[model samples]
Target: MTAPATKPQAAPAALALADDALVLAQRLGEWAGHAPVLEEDVALANIALDLLGQARVLYTLLGDEDELAYLREERAFRNAQLVEQPNGDFAHTIARQLYFSTYHHLLHTQLATTPAPDAATEDTTAPDIRALAAKAAKETAYHREHAELWTLRLGDGTPESHHRMQRAIDTLWRYTGELFQDLDGLQLDLHTLESNWHTAITDTLTQATLTVPESPRTSAWTAGAGRQGLHTETFGRMLAEMQHLHRSHPGASW
Candidate 1:
């Protein structure tokens, strides 16, 4: 008798989560030398490394981490458009981090606390995924707190700082809806995730004395197809830069 074909649905879901972490890590790493304060240089790098570690674990579960990260084409990436956005300024970076880390922490919390499937029906990778989620939840909590403090600092600082923080919040609002989009193979409640995210964001903005942007989360002009392999023009440039060295030195390693 022939063996049944193994279902590969989980790989795409894992890849999506992994891509989000990896791309955002790369974005944060770009701030290594450019952060406003010397301390921020180290802080941002630590957060980036935490995200990189999560991405590496997820990638290892799927396949070769280097090949998956370096060889994938732009359209092949499954990261949310929010994470791919340019680090416009310190405020922009903080806004992006605040938005994503909040969502990521909630997501990992759900994944970590979810009950494991029965042995009879469990897939081989389930335990590892849950374990990774558990560890990542702790790390992302710090990421979220760091972003929150920065948000408050910038939002209520001098006039220019307040203006930039508000602008960053408004500019990035549209890209956030995609965070709650359905991901295959994950049995999470999207509605709950969206609601919690909204509440958390609203509270933080209020505390910082910034208005929560009224822009629609999803609209004709908003981004939403990243999971379907569609990406923004800027993503293409970023991907090119990220993949350049690996492609240039194929099969060569230090």
Candidate 2:
């Protein structure tokens, strides 16, 4: 009798997660010396380092961490569009962080509680993913808190600050739907994840005294496609800058 076919491993999910962390780390790192205040520079840098560490673990699972992060072409990355967005103003950055870190924290929490994969019957990557999620959930809790506090401070601040915060929320609202997309390989239910995300975001926004933007109309264009490796126009420029050092130095490393 012919042997049963071996199911392919779920590399896409891992790659997507890795790319999200890696790209966001790079974006956040851009604010290292440029943050609005000295304390924020340190805070943002710490967050970036945490994300970079997560990316390294995820990338190591796939193969060479450096190659996967530095050598990938524009069409090869699988990060969400939200993370790759330009950090506009302080409010804009905080808004993006609030949305993503909340989602991340919730997702990791769920994953940590998920039943372990059957070693004999399922992909081995499941155990690794769960382990990673457990650790990451802790870190993301801090991230979520940081973003939430800032959201409140900016949203309920002076009139000008409030206006900027509200505008930031509205601008980034369109990109958010992409985070809830149902990908093929993830074990978690995307619909459930999205529901939790919405509830959490709504509650936080309400507390911040900020208006949550109306959901996009069915006919309106939503930004996604990153899971399928497509990215925004600005992503190319970001990629160029990120890869420059590695490309220029070749195999050199400190």
Candidate 3:
């Protein structure tokens, strides 16, 4: 007798990566008029646009970008929990940026430098992935530097600012491990990626006079299942807000 066929899963790498960019871009775009200064308002918006551009490229590689981004249910999104996290305050936003941009820069650097496997000739997505990685690496490098500078300013600035920066870093540290977790179709060595990320984060924190949290990044109590479609409570609300207009308009486009 023939066996029953299993359903195919979404392309984990493309979906997850694209979701990461999309979610974070939404979060950053929230700072439009609320940023601490006019300069920060414009800066965050530009960064959000950059991330949105990246997400569009990645989503296009998968299928209908609109359907994948706007039509998907909350549980279907595969973004890392870190990116979906609510941007608490200016310092908290900077902390999230510090952690994610560092990881993003490192991950894209690997993708840009690493040669595609033999199967890439047949896999049309490989070249696009490489090109996106190459382009995004440059963009994320700026993101990393921006985060690093802010982390330093906030962490070392004043007593209140320092305390807030420290608290933000500690609060978000647990969500970071998921960044290094294995994803399908990514051929880079996770060990090296993680090690480099650790060193970079450590150096930045040390320079900022901030302490790296002793808390574990992954554990039963910490978040790690986002790639498996699990997420925090905040994600549902954020998704609703992000998809509201798109879903409401249903194919209406300017």
Candidate 4:
């Protein structure tokens, strides 16, 4: 896609941002035929494709097309710990989609305005970035809706489903903070982004009768350095599988 970094904003620091998208896409693909309902199965598969498409375009922005897709080593990968976390159950997968998509909507929107919200209409790239942002915004809206509907349905339905949903929230909830984390040269205004995200996520959860992870707990949660190429144990396993073919026969291409 050859995404250009906005004039006032620099390009992403690592291909790892794109790596996060790619890994989540792959993990979601695992549920293609196993969702509890037909509509859900279709929805999840489509979301997986959407994430994969974004990843492909983002990777192209970072470097050599073929190499970026498959040539990276495990220690070189840059996806967040949340995306790489195993899809433990149906509840877990749904929670994953919900949380990530909501964050995407907020992050992309904020990035779109980074060039100065007033300058947005005057800049030529603004039109293009705005369109891209609009598309992603719509997709994320649907993703959040689908995920929350599923969460509520499951959480409010049976006793077993309710328990599972809460457990999913507890385990997966901690990983949410890393999404809004801003680092040096990240091209994001961390404080502003964090405030906006807190508002958006809390409002969304409130409607679903869910609580945001308390700040103290989130504070105590360990931060994984996915952005810096540090990864959890399973992440290496995933990278190994994804990179195996390209590594075994470097420079051999179709």
Q: Which candidate is the best by lDDT?
A: 3
User: lDDT of candidate 2?
Assistant: 0.85
**82-187, model 4: which lDDT tens digit per residue?**
8898888998887787778777777666666566455532443334444455566677667777877887787676878777776787777777777766532345
lDDT of 3 by residue, 29-90 (tens): 99999999999999999999999999998887777789999999988999999999999999
TM-score of candidate 4 versus the correct structure, residues matched by position: 0.80
- Candidate 1, number of clashes: 0
Where does model 3 exceed 4 Å of error?
1-10, 120-122, 222-224
- Model 1: per-residue Cα lDDT over 99-174, one tens digit each: 9999999999888997876755445555666789999999999999999999999998989999999999999898
What's the lDDT for all of these models?
0.87, 0.85, 0.88, 0.68
TM-score of each: 0.94, 0.92, 0.93, 0.80
RMSD of each: 3.2, 4.1, 4.7, 4.2
Q: What is the C-alpha lDDT profile of model 2 across 46-157, one tens digit per residue?
A: 9999999988887777787889988989999999888999999999999999989998998889889878656654475656767899999999999999999999999989
lDDT of 4 at 109: 69
By lDDT rank, best first, the candidates go 3, 1, 2, 4
User: Where is model 4 more than 4 Å wrong at Cα?
Assistant: 1-9, 113-131, 183-186, 215-224, 245-254
Q: Arrange candidates, best TM-score first.
A: 1, 3, 2, 4
